[model samples]
Target: MSLTGGSVSVRHPAQHRGRSRLSPQAYLATTGRILRQLLADHRSVAMILVVPSLIITLMYFMFQNAPHRPGAPSPFNNACLIMLGVFPLIVMFLITSITMQRERVSGTLERILTTPLRRLDLLAAYGTAFSIAAAAQATLACVVSYWFLGLYTEGSPVLVFLIAIINAVLGVGLGLLCSAFARTEFQAVQFMPVVIAPQLLLCGIIVPRDLLPDWLQWISNVLPASYALEALQEVGAYPEPTFVAVRDIAVVVGFAVLALCLAAATLRRRTP
Candidate 1:
């Protein structure tokens, strides 16, 4: 972006190897770099991640002495599953916004734009990084919850791992779409409420759809979490819940693909 250095020559396709296709290895490498960046960024790691863990802890204490039914199931497992959908939204948004916005302002994104590397690959890298970060955080949270709050699950850890990974990946793809559309870092931050807050309120988290009005229930049904929550709960609380949870996993994969297309469309646009 600096004109004082005279003309800048962008590298051609043959000049670079990793940018041409969406390589999972390349994506994982970029994700490692991004994690190093996060470790260096201690403040962000605390606010977006540590704070949520603290919030969960506080909620547990506040509800500790409450009444319990004779035959009621522990809702914590499913609640954690519900939290997976919304919590990753924040983490993914933070990850994508920080990295992409920095690149955009520093001209790194501009340089990459002229290359053979597809925008989808670029976005996929961010999502990959976020997915890894989310997994680590979820593991930490699960450990803390089990040790301190007596959290237990009747479901398989393998299933939980799958759900967490898919949820994180899908969330990161969504965050990329949000970051791509944002004109500025502040705008990206602003987009969070519009993008994620709705899902938190309506995705069978706070208020169930059946309790809401007919139109509102219909609206909530369209949310990604509507399907995801069912899958998560089925794996946790209601092991025999209707519909195949594996199919919901498929839906999460579909969302990731769809979000990749949105990212591609975003980078493809011209100033006109």
Candidate 2:
């Protein structure tokens, strides 16, 4: 970047043959900057830390009076376990996407890219910061559900919290990828219905995958959210994480990694 008269222009980073090496200093600096920005926003902080718990609390009451089958878990308990994963994914997706989009619109991302920061460095920084926020968000939601809201799972609450954190990180990855296609914050908001809602309906939270039509089942099989819901369901049914549950957790992690790679591939030093 240079100044000519009163105008300043950014010189885009030259294309490299392969992925740029991530620098420790650049990664830490970028991560610190993004973390600072996130902490500076009170609204984002509230949404991240409180919204999932609030939603779970509301669901608890809404189903409080519903009938319970004699031998099976109450509907509220089942739904609460599944939602513990979903809410984080949805909330983080929205926050991360919008925040990244804001950085792009403000030219902060471009300026940073023009420096020694590789795309991977910037993305990893965003991931690390959001992952920390996600851990807190998942922890609060799990604590409230198990202790305050009377949610119970056959498996350990620790497993449930871990799944929720993974789901939240998955959200962060998808959000970053979506932000690349959105020119404005409102456009990023519009992506929730397109990207998240379908997953919600199809993830076996609303209806069991076995009960769905064969084609819908096939589609659900391909969505990352389905694996998350399945993992939670396994945890609910078993006292320990089963082989299926472990496999499902691995699938969610793989999908999150894929989304992050795609997001990095989509990054541009300058929007055109």
Candidate 3:
């Protein structure tokens, strides 16, 4: 086609095609591939699901003899809540970021992008696959905490399990986002200190937010883990769900969605 006077320009048919809509089949295929890879890696499977439970059990025994007032909150309960909220975040973050970095380095992601796969489909597939593992991990942690460790909760154990899963998913989202910036597995692992350590310090896990300085408290309020820990605490302390508990859950979910969207947007088809 003549553009102006003597210049001829042509548009490729592929360029004319609009953005591909997400396909469930493609998403499931990607998810299944990831799940199969994870299953084959026996070490990863144990690290993702089993190690956290073992750690929680150790904590239970360590705190079993701690002194507590008759009406005061139990140290064991607080430790269990912290384990549920933080353990999955740490494990899932390491797994997702390192796995994604490996894919990027191996040119697998570039090859996948050459196909008709949408970025959102890939991101959702990672999220879904890790979420399944996350759910299993959370379940194991909760069961061991409740049965073996003798964790007593005023609220439903089901609620604790649900919140723990959400927290794990949040880690997956953050891991994906962080992976875009990492060129090596070491860099991905380094993100734990830079991205997650601060949250752990400020998320009321080690020290209660109320006891923190005003500025630190403000920082804590913005961190998603803070809300997760808060929700778990509420569930342990209250017989019925309270408004604060629901609100904290919503905030944690919102953070997870926001992180995932950022991850999809920032993902590159190939490493530079």
Candidate 4:
């Protein structure tokens, strides 16, 4: 097009030309960072990957073959798999404050903020890394729980994958929310025993809500992880179809957005 001064104005293609979108690349890079960090901390890596498996295996041997078998054919196996739903989130919670907050303390956060990259992008990358870390542990546990221990999933493996992803994302969201306000990594780690262990006890993972006291049933219903664990057990082992599935998906999504917003607000507070 010709302008008023007899100058030509050219329009660039809206299609991004040769440039590719960044989500996949960013996610890959983020995954790489997570692996590197995990590798750097050998003991921590052992705790995340090995401990969960050991505990899971111990559960399989002890619970699956117990004298008082569950109502379902694969009661013990189902319970072990249910346990996997809780670990990813707990591990992510323990690590988020350690890694992301440490960046803030070390001035790296300020440097990143000065770049063209978005605050949300940084949040996402870290969150993705944590989610993947949790997912890895969960998947490894599922393999043993299902194939070796005779855990049954009436639903498809694909469905289990979806549920696990949802659980990981929800965990990352909660972890990020905690990270945003936690003053130090020690405090973050300290908070976990209080924050996560109760969920395990109250959430449908360890025990069925119907069997719990009336007051406690309401408590578990309000917890996003509780719904997720129920959904996973349904799609993975037990295969129950109910409103809890849809409700869990909604709760997980809501918590994710809340966590992201909290992280952003915290970052903004730290900004000039």
Model 4, C-alpha of 45: deviation from truth (Å): 3.0
Question: For each candidate, how many residue pairs have backbone atoms clashing (under 3 Å)?
Answer: 0, 0, 0, 0
In TM-score terms, which candidate is top? Answer: 3
lDDT of 2 by residue, 105-200 (tens): 888988887776778768888999999999999889888999898888899989999999999999999999999999899999999999999999
Cα error, residue 264 of model 1, in Å, equals: 2.2
Q: Cα miss at 193, model 4 (Å)?
A: 3.3
Output candidate 1 Cα RMSD.
Answer: 6.7
Which ten residues in a row are the worst by lDDT in model 2? 10-19
True lDDT of residue 258, candidate 1? 88
The residue-level lDDT of candidate 1 at 40 comes to 86
Model 3 clashing-pair count? 0
Which residue runs of candidate 4 sit more than 4 Å off their true CA positions? 1-35, 69-71, 205-208, 211-216, 236-243, 268-272
Q: Write the per-residue lDDT of candidate 1 for residues 201-236, one digit (tens) a residue.
A: 787777776798898888887777666776777777
Q: After superposition, how far is residue 258 of candidate 1 from its true place, in Å?
A: 1.0
lDDT of 3 by residue, 1-272 (tens): 76656977776755533355657788889999999999999999999888999888888889889999998878988888888889888999999999999999999999887767777778889999999999999888988888888888899999999998898899999999999998888998999998899999998777889999999999898999999989998999999999999999999999999999999999987668
